[model samples]
Target: MSELLDNTEAATKAVVDWLTKKAKTKSKFYIKDFYKIFPDDKPRAIKKVVNKMVETGELEFWSSGSTTMYGLKGGGIQHSSEGES
Candidate 1:
């Protein structure tokens, strides 16, 4: 059981990593895009994992019409100093 859980975690991480990389180049990704990236897994399962990532602050979401777009947080911005702008 523990091994299964570990594999599941790894798979989820793989999906997250893939999405993060894609989002870096593109502003948004829809559910079908995820399915294309990971065709072996069901779309619903992928969405579930994505929701978990959103909850954990690893992903951010926006809605456009009937689609939900996802992207990385911070928008690739990095802060160097607190009051040294």
Candidate 2:
């Protein structure tokens, strides 16, 4: 419905703002980090918004082989798989 879309859009903007303004010094974040931003919302709902951002090209995935992270697209330390063991 239109209400659902509006809420999702608002959440998406809140996340983008947090990444750009509040957590500006950090490049990557964990899913748990977003819990602090939307304490009233269910974790599943938050994940939905974040994953949507990834699908929309607003964020990108970062991995260190063992762990996965999220960061603003083109705004964090570049990851290269060229020289790895």
Candidate 3:
């Protein structure tokens, strides 16, 4: 049980670091973009970590009407349903 917790923590850190440090130039990404960050880890696990970040307000969802992408909160242009004239 403890080992699982440790793994989860490490995975979470890795994802955050990649988003903040490595992918700093990019603002938004598809879920599939995270798969390579943890090549040995299952894609499902990667998705789980990213989703958890989203839930915790560390990341946010950006939609372009037809598609949705993810980005760090306040890191780049955010889409909102306001001021549309």
Candidate 4:
């Protein structure tokens, strides 16, 4: 396997852009799944980028049946916490 070789800023953009595409279809994604797309970076590193994206509002996340999923802001996706019993 090649060494992880991606600039932090570029990696961040790649992740955000990928999620943006998914958002167009109102699709949800997980951090682990993202690592598969951006395999150039380590899983932990990808996680940091994802978390930062959420923190800065580039992406929005919510829990679903114990799984955390992320979607683009204004994508109209709701969380598991909403009126679930």
Q: Best candidate per TM-score, number?
A: 2
Model 1 accuracy (lDDT, Cα): 0.63
**TM-scores of the models, in the order given:** 0.64, 0.79, 0.73, 0.69
Query: Which should have the higher TM-score, number 2 or number 3?
Result: 2
lDDT of 4 by residue, 28-55 (tens): 7777879776766677777777788788
Ranking by lDDT: 2, 3, 4, 1
Q: Which lDDT values do the candidates have, in the order given?
A: 0.63, 0.78, 0.73, 0.69
* Highest lDDT model number: 2
RMSD each, Å: 6.1, 3.6, 3.5, 3.9
What residue pairs clash in candidate 2, if any at all? none
* lDDT string, candidate 2, 1-85, tens digits: 2243349777787888889885568878988898777877778877878899999999887877998888788776564433577
Task: Please list the residue runs of candidate 4 whose C-alpha ends up more than 4 Å from where it truly belongs after superposition.
Answer: 1-6, 24-26, 79-85
CA shift of 25, model 2, Å: 1.4
- What would the TM-score be for candidate 2 when compared with the true structure? 0.79
Q: By the lDDT metric, which is better: model 3 or model 4?
A: 3
lDDT by residue for model 1 (52-76), tens: 7678887777765687777665443
Off by over 4 Å in 3: 1-6, 79-85
